[model samples]
Target: MILDRQLLLSNAQPITATAVSTNTIDLAIARDIGIGDNLELFIKVIAAFAGGTSVQFAFITSANADLSSATVIVQTPAIPTASLVAGSEWLRVQVPALSQAAAMQRYIGVSYTVVGTFTGGTVTAGLALDREGTAYYPSGLNSGGF
Candidate 1:
């Protein structure tokens, strides 16, 4: 999957606490982004997470660039820390289609809410043209290709 830098929401951002994404996609600036083709948001664990009971990832949109008072379009269930291994794909979902996107606000971004203490974790999130995510299997099980 090709990731465009301009569509990036978070780039290897460390998550020690609850926080908004480092960047946002301004729909006014990139009006054509999700118009013609479907785009997917990819959130990957760049570093092993430790000390957090669970974490939830939210996809939000708002009129302000700061993302305050935003509407959450979609979100992940609280993911247990035990499952947050490095290189894991936390969330991958398609961006809204043109009709839906048009009715929303102008800014899009991600939010990380950690339940309990989050001592260590790094994540990278962005919009991509393809899913291209890895499929993990239990030990001793191999599907020729994923």
Candidate 2:
């Protein structure tokens, strides 16, 4: 995939898992991003004050910058089987292309959330990958247009 890793957020503040205001992540998608490509996400846990907490990640798509009209695209299946281990914990996720559905309007992003009690976890940085993002045809073309 032709993608680049870009930082979405770097929080010195601890994330409150229950609140979207604290745990949500949003990224701006380039207008020319390819429909065949997708934006991948990563959440690297810098610290978790409490261990053994199950966390989940969710993906959302939106047309607005504030993520007001957002739709949950990839619903986190369930709380992760494993528990947080401070520096050892990291997650990777991706959003699927709209495919036959109409082209993505303007923006795309993902978030990390947990169902149960979560307190004092710091995410050093949230990174994203926009596959084939360098150009609509990031993969380049074959000779003779074949």
Candidate 3:
């Protein structure tokens, strides 16, 4: 899958505590998003989350850049710390069509809610146009001729 840097909400962002994404997609300028096609959000665990009982991921929209008055458009159930391993694809969801139904906020981003203290964790999140499911390929022939 191809991820656009401009559409990225977070790039290996740390999750030591509950916080909003480092970056946000500005829907006001990128007016083409969530119009005729569905926009997908991808969240990957770059580092194993530790010292946290659980964590919930939320897709939020806000009128302010700092997400002072944010609203959750969608969210995932509280995930146990054991499941938050490195290289895990925590979430991949289609962004709702807010523009079609009603007035929409200008900024959209990701937020992490931790139930306990998180000493370590890192995540990478972004917007993607498409994503292929997880698959493994056979290793290339080694030493021996095919």
lDDT of 1 by residue, 9-44 (tens): 999999989988999988777356656777998899
Q: Which tens-of-lDDT digit does each residue in 19-82 have in candidate 2?
A: 2323333334334434455555555567754642566655556676555666676555545425
Instruction: Please give the ranking of all candidate structures by lDDT, highest first, separated by commas.
Output: 1, 3, 2
lDDT of residue 72 for candidate 1: 92
Candidates 1 and 3 compared: the better one by TM-score is 1
- After superposition, the stretches of candidate 1 with alpha carbons farther than 4 Å from their true spots are 98-102, 133-146
**In model 1, how large is the Cα lDDT of residue 108?**
85
Q: Candidate 2: worst 10 consecutive residues by lDDT?
A: 18-27
The clash number for model 2 is: 0
For lDDT, candidate 1 versus 2, the one ahead is 1
Which segments of model 3 are wrong by more than 4 Å? 30-35, 101-103, 135-146
Which one is best on TM-score?
1
Residue 1 in model 2: lDDT: 37
Q: For each candidate, what TM-score against the reference?
A: 0.85, 0.52, 0.84
Which is the leading candidate under lDDT? 1
